[model samples]
Target: MRKCRFAPGGIYHIYNRGVDKREVFISESDYIRFLCSLYRFNDIAPTSNLHRIAYDVRGLTSNISDKPDKRKRLVNILYYALRPNHFHMTLQELIEKGIEKFMQKIGTGYTMYFNKKNKRSGALFQGTFKAIAIESERYLMEISRYIHLNPLKNIEPEFREKGVENIDKAKDFLLHYKWSSFLDYVSIKNFPLLINNEIHKGYFKDASQHKDFVFEGLFEVKPRTCKGIL
Candidate 1:
């Protein structure tokens, strides 16, 4: 695991993969459950009775924030993609270590749920989650666009290959995809129980501007990659 700066109000690209190359999400239900955890951190529901009977479990707990007295919510989900073996999220940290704390809570909560539900044990993820800070406004918007376009690489590969020509339709697909925060960013839906509103709104000027910004990047954007700490 690499060391990351836990800066306040910072935007970060966080990601992780499943143990080995095994499927992190085997079905639509599994993906939905994970997405629900992202939004409802500290409020995750307990595993079902059927899940309890399948495997021994431990470390189960609520997904609530640790700083009960903090007036403002920390960690805003800008965008996310739930893939089969890995997942990615772009978030703005409202409080210090908010991303770390949020990920820790969900990771612990989900491990127990999965162990029981799948009749498996041990760890679910490879190790600690990785995060890369977006140091500039340019990177922030571009990274968020990349995160949202991830699912389209699956559903509309041809469009992606030709560049973001049909991104409006892609945006529509994102809105319909229940597992991502795309809808939250676009103002199509709101899930305040799980997401921070003010922090999210800070990501864009407006939906139309955001859409145009993303589409422009499709043709001229340079590929950016990160290795190790941000």
Candidate 2:
């Protein structure tokens, strides 16, 4: 196993791409499955195989008595974005070794589901995920802006380099983008269950302020020049 210097109560930007730059998410279902894994696999307790559980309970109507116990989360997922070939997350360790344990579960659980669905795989991710410690408040806010604006690459590939062509169009695109936590940050309630908003609350006054922060930084924020740090 790769050793990580993740510390308790520390924030880190975590990311990984697919093997050989392959597409890890081939379709909408693949994205949904991965999102479900993100929600289901953060527990400190061992869980039954998610794929198996879903299959076993297929077509069954749930009774009112089937409520499961609340999960003890390993880490606090501040924000996340899923792309076709890669993904990014802003996470804070909640306990000792929380980030490592959470990543292990996410990588292992999602790989099994993805490989089985695609019917061919040695490894889905390139290798161990990369992490960069957020050492300052300014750095944390900048990284958050970067992660949120990442989807603009799909529409405006040069936005990061030269700035957005049409800020209005870019903002609209981000507002409707479904694969990232951008919507949640903007108070759209897309995937509120997947994130812990305590950290974000301390940074932005509210959703409107958060949206303003993202848009206002478009001109000043430069493209990430370093590898494995965004």
Which candidate number has the best TM-score? 2
RMSD (CA, angstroms), candidate 2: 3.9
Relative to the true structure, candidate 1 reaches a TM of 0.71
Q: Output the worst ten-in-a-row residue range by lDDT, candidate 2.
A: 56-65
- Candidate 2 on 8-74: residue-level lDDT in tens? 8889989999999899888877777777677667889897667654421121223211456388888
Clashing pairs in 2: none
The list of candidate 1 runs beyond 4 A from truth reads: 42-74, 156-172, 190-193, 197-203, 220-222, 225-230
Q: What are the per-residue Cα lDDT tens digits for candidate 1 across 118-228?
A: 999999998999888778867776677776666665666544446655657766776677555566566665333345546445776787666666555556433454223
Model 1 poorest 10 in a row by lDDT: 53-62
Q: Model 2 segments beyond 4 Å from truth?
A: 1-4, 52-69, 221-230
Q: Estimate each model's TM-score.
A: 0.71, 0.88
Taking every candidate in turn, the Cα RMSD to the unseen true structure, in Å, is 6.6, 3.9
Give the best candidate by lDDT. 2
